[model samples]
Target: AAAQAAAWLAGGGLPDPEAGLKWGYMEGATDYLFEEREPSPGVAYVRLVPVLRAEPTGHDLIDELLREPRSWRWDGHGESMDWWPAVLPSHREVVAVNYLPHLLYQWNHAGVYPPYLEALCQADGPVGDATAIALAYFLSTDAERGVPLLLRMAARGDLPAAAVGRQLTHLIRRAGHQTRPVVAALAVAAREGAYEQVWEILRAMLPGLLPGEGERPNVTHTEAVTLAADVATWAKAGGEVPATVSAYAMSKRTSRFARECRRLRTQLT
Candidate 1:
């Protein structure tokens, strides 16, 4: 309904050519100047869109997002770039991040790739941070493609650490026990000035990084732990290690990871 209204306004419903107002113009807008929240419970106030600039960005999704800035609620709506149509061509199935493992399998069988990856993997690719993050959901299992792409992005500093921090945390959480490669890759990125990003990911993922109860750590799992400890030390981050990790650190297991965990215990203590 609102789209139709916008279309009608774009059509012949505009008042006059002399009138300076243009539809969807978001200029001279400040939170104090406009309503940040609904004026009343269960009621929305009329939006005041001030027109200060009329030039288009030549990108549709960017335009729409900037169109109704007040109406965009990332907290309420899905934060993926998949919520709207993209202007660029790509083999990606939009909104497929949750089903990425399955979608990637099908794409592999069909011998195709998400075209956006080509640019995203390059230095300062044409894509934005949201696109890179959305695609990162499958990074751990997507060893052939997504992992390499992530490594390159981190190495080149293609996106700001702050912009990708939350997604990086989620990436490690999704990886679980298979976090060795990603953690190792992140250690390199940390030395390149993303140590803060590594620390944030560990804070969010350490408790869950361990194997399930009563299950011994596999080779890959132990490697992940060792790399995580290295990152914690590099970041000089000292906090209470999760109870499970602390318990294992106290045990007499003499493997590389157990030793590292004990060292971590000494530092964190």
Candidate 2:
């Protein structure tokens, strides 16, 4: 899965304790087994898996989550599942995207927004997971709060920039919300010297900016255009530069991909 791929890319490997043992795949291998090289033993082995996601005892809230509709979308990385309207009745670390509107409405009307927001802020899980996306969208209802929250997370490396960008684009498609705040958050991250991560995030947003072969531009297209324009302006500023801008600035650098940066620069310009 994408998570596994990410772990591998970051130099994470299986926790194998046994030497010269089962090294071949078995049924359900993908679900439980991971392989690591062990030169000392001339082979590698496995460790018994533990419950990675443990639920609190008497966690009755799961019933409410199960009752929500099950819907998801696949990306190059993997699947992302979320419910519509993006709110929840009782805030939990994991939430139903569909119930968010109702949940937010009730919370606001009942003067209980803090508990829900607090839950989103404190809830922990995998990086760039569904809950993170939901939190970004839910917090976005109040940009003053949401934008800074996202920026802080990105700056601190708590949330991946690509995840935040993709989730913001998804939010635009589902909620018809503006993404200016999100773009600004990205700019803040760029200023904090996260140029490489910011560039990947912006690259994820590029699909939204370009039109299909024969399709007419829509509201989403316009929003994407506006986002790109803002990013371009930030790129030209005298402060910390965005990766796209830096790639063009340092085209001779061996690490930079000049052609790709030039292509995106041409579009944004």
Candidate 3:
């Protein structure tokens, strides 16, 4: 049925301008069916009915049909299916249904710093934070566009800062810590001195590292302890860590790691 439909449309089996078909620019029509028409060489009047429907089942049907070799042909033959009647609903439907929501979820976040950190905690798997971070970083190059998206994600609590930071670190290590597009985007944000934006991305991730059953694996007690010490040292040197940073410092940890972080912070200062 699908192949016959496709073949018929390709052969102008339904209607044509010479057939005086009046489809009236249907928005979503895969093929046109000729209902009534006056056949003439130079003068013909035909009324066209859209063959494709917009219902979900109809979409599935079209998808199945398009995948079949028998339903479509792309050769340069006369009246080829290549330029036959337009496909219904269009490619925009595919993006709207599948890609855009996932993309928006990942991209509209704090930024790379926190999201990266979160990625480190996930077990090696396909649907991990790592994938999200990679995608967000790819899309983050457009600062004007990307920054707002990040902020939107942050506002929505879709991403956290610590996670982002870890992800960034992972990506840095993967890229040999050298300047790549993702790093460059961060550098640009840093140079622009968008500290609030940077902080938000970072702060969002901090809650995940708090002492709890769901605490992330990447942000171990030792790392958290060391990070706290680093924050203090940075603070003493007139650098202010976000409130979330200090909050994370209060989590449970080994005394040795805690002491070591504090010692490191002091030494660094």
Candidate 4:
């Protein structure tokens, strides 16, 4: 089904803005098909939005479509078949009405968008998973917010532990923070057992306190050591321990500190 859609788009069968298309496999079909059409404009727009599947071709199709020199205009009905129209009186409105929802729906249905949009968003620097999370956070509300954000954060292995930890701590300190809710949201990623996030949080927070001071009123080294140990254990078990752990350990000059760090690294591995 996806191949057919790609061939169609590649062959220049422009998308009917009114009749959205889902460009991947469907229930009983091998290739992609025009799955649904809604009577109402908004509904139809949401229904027909194309979600690319697989690689190379999926990516190629999107690039081709985006590059087509067309000023897209959405009719009042929220659908337009024309690739390039003379007047797009409501460019912003058309984008919001016809494009934004589809982009968001792609995010919701495909787990993530193609690298093109993701790269566009992070073009300035290493935005990492935060870019994806921020989009999801804005598109979704309340209960749906943290789950997607955390998932993206977890996937982007390049994120520094310190940065992730700080974000997690800040979120936990927010007025509405609830342990169960926060932990539950994070648990999915945690189950992947990548302790980089846990370590990242600890590494970020530990340096902020005075030598003997704890992060929060009741938190203590015992707690810190325990959490660190737990993270180390999980990371080692999952074979996802960051090389930084050993590097940080080896860079230390103090014999005792170096020994402890090495021990921690060993434990994590």
Candidate 5:
């Protein structure tokens, strides 16, 4: 049912079950997805959850996704079933764990701040540890969402800072040129008073995002430095800019990178 909603919102009808796989919701999505929607925090997640997650949480969930329109059989009806909006009682929990995350992800791709997932990223308890390990192990699917979640979790002493830091580095590198929104999210978080938590993630992320310590700066690097400066300024950050940034600031007196470095460096003092 949710998958149909995904399909409908994505500008298509429900996909056939017998039909082979589908593309990323067809990219023909209507403007509904951009309306800024998310489920209430009260929506069920940890409660009634399976003690053992089904083999990590990304691909498997996608594999189990319900793409066909939901329908059901009636006792009086012929063998053919009715295809409309209906949920089989048995499939409730299945959808919660398997389909809900993806739906939530589609809605809040940039926010990536799902509290339930954050709750799952706990360290000590079995559920928490399992989730933390699962998310960290195959972060390629989780990077956009999981990286920032880990930062917040680590800040609260729920997960390890070093490990979270490493993932932040991986996220920055993996995102490559697309790291703009990710960086913007951090800056927004800092501007909203998450300075220390955001800075910790940035310290790990910035070096890789920037050109190497003394390597020649390019347009890409220029953008990276500018974004970092935006973050540092918002965070009111109090620490050294990365060596790469500092060296570049000194390398060219008037280039864009140097100018961004000056703005970034000033925040440190």
Candidate 6:
């Protein structure tokens, strides 16, 4: 109905120009001040349209929820214990939004992050939401256990697998301490084919693996490099994976990083 009204307005006029308005010409020009004192009898006219009432959409609801207090305790127990009830309803309600991670974290005052994660993973929500949820979990908690789950979500096509890879790189840069576990989890996912964009993930990680001039390679950098190699080897694309990585490495703007990427690409080849 709204579309029809918009279409009607677009095609001509809302009430139609020919019949609705009574125009008069004066001095060979369109009289701007013409007004109808009264309608002539026997002429049919359109009734006035009522004002439209604004209704909230799912996005609107999510916005309204942003102002909600972060801390929560649904049951008698405090944030230390499992607080399933505090976030279950919200998970069900906000899963429709593509950015579920932000919504979930906003409402995670009671330390129910895990429960929110479990609910989102099990609820059959949008794939983007699930992917966001996984990335959010990894960034906030550095929990590698979520990697495979993220891979599964990516496999479902809610979002590109490259997004997960990019987030993994971000996670490593932010919290290098958790690098080992994240890499291990990613290796397992790749071998199992839980996600298909292993090549993209490796490519994004290449620059990070390179050390600046005269700088020594760190533990996290070496671990990440090994992980990327493992993913490239196990990936179904065979030699094409190395070729793609080599192309990206050669195209890099930073000479040092580019040289490093090409070297790594050679090892894979």
Pitting candidate 3 against candidate 6, the one with the higher TM-score is: 6
Error of 6 at 263 (Å): 7.2
After superposing candidate 3 on the true structure, give the runs of residues whose Cα lies further than 4 Å from its correct spot: 1-131, 134-136, 176-269
* lDDT of all predictions: 0.46, 0.42, 0.35, 0.38, 0.44, 0.43
Q: How accurate is candidate 5 locally (lDDT)?
A: 0.44
Weakest 10 consecutive residues, lDDT, candidate 4?
Answer: 84-93
* Candidate 4 residue pairs in clash (backbone atoms < 3 Å): 1-30, 1-31, 1-32, 2-32, 18-79, 20-48, 21-48, 161-200, 165-201
Question: How far is each candidate from the true structure, as Cα RMSD in Å?
Answer: 14.4, 16.3, 21.9, 17.3, 16.2, 20.4
**Models sorted by lDDT, best on top:** 1, 5, 6, 2, 4, 3
lDDT of 6 by residue, 140-256 (tens): 354455655556555665543554555455444432325566666656666667534655566655555445556655565555566666555555333443433465467845544
Better of 2 and 3 by lDDT: 2
Measured by TM-score, how close is model 2 to the native structure?
Answer: 0.42
lDDT per residue as tens, model 1, 148-174: 555565566553343244444444543
Clashing pairs in 6: none
Mark the regions of model 6 whose C-alpha exceeds 4 Å error after superposition.
1-63, 66-109, 123-133, 139-144, 175-177, 236-269
> Cα lDDT for residue 70, model 1?
28
Query: Model 1 Cα displacement at 67 (Å)?
Result: 19
By TM-score, how accurate is candidate 4? Answer: 0.31
In terms of lDDT, the best-performing candidate is: 1
Worst 10 residues of 1 by lDDT: 16-25
Off by over 4 Å in 2: 1-115, 127-129, 138-140, 179-181, 192-196, 215-269
Question: In model 4, where do residues sit more than 4 Å from their true spots?
Answer: 1-125, 128-145, 156-160, 172-184, 206-227, 237-269
lDDT of 5 by residue, 1-269 (tens): 56755765376332222211111111223211111443233322211112212322233434444443222212432221111113322222232222222322233232222343543443222222223323332233445575566556546665543343444444344322245555555555556555666566566666666766456777756765676677667666777668877776666579887898887787776
Write down the lDDT that model 3 would get: 0.35
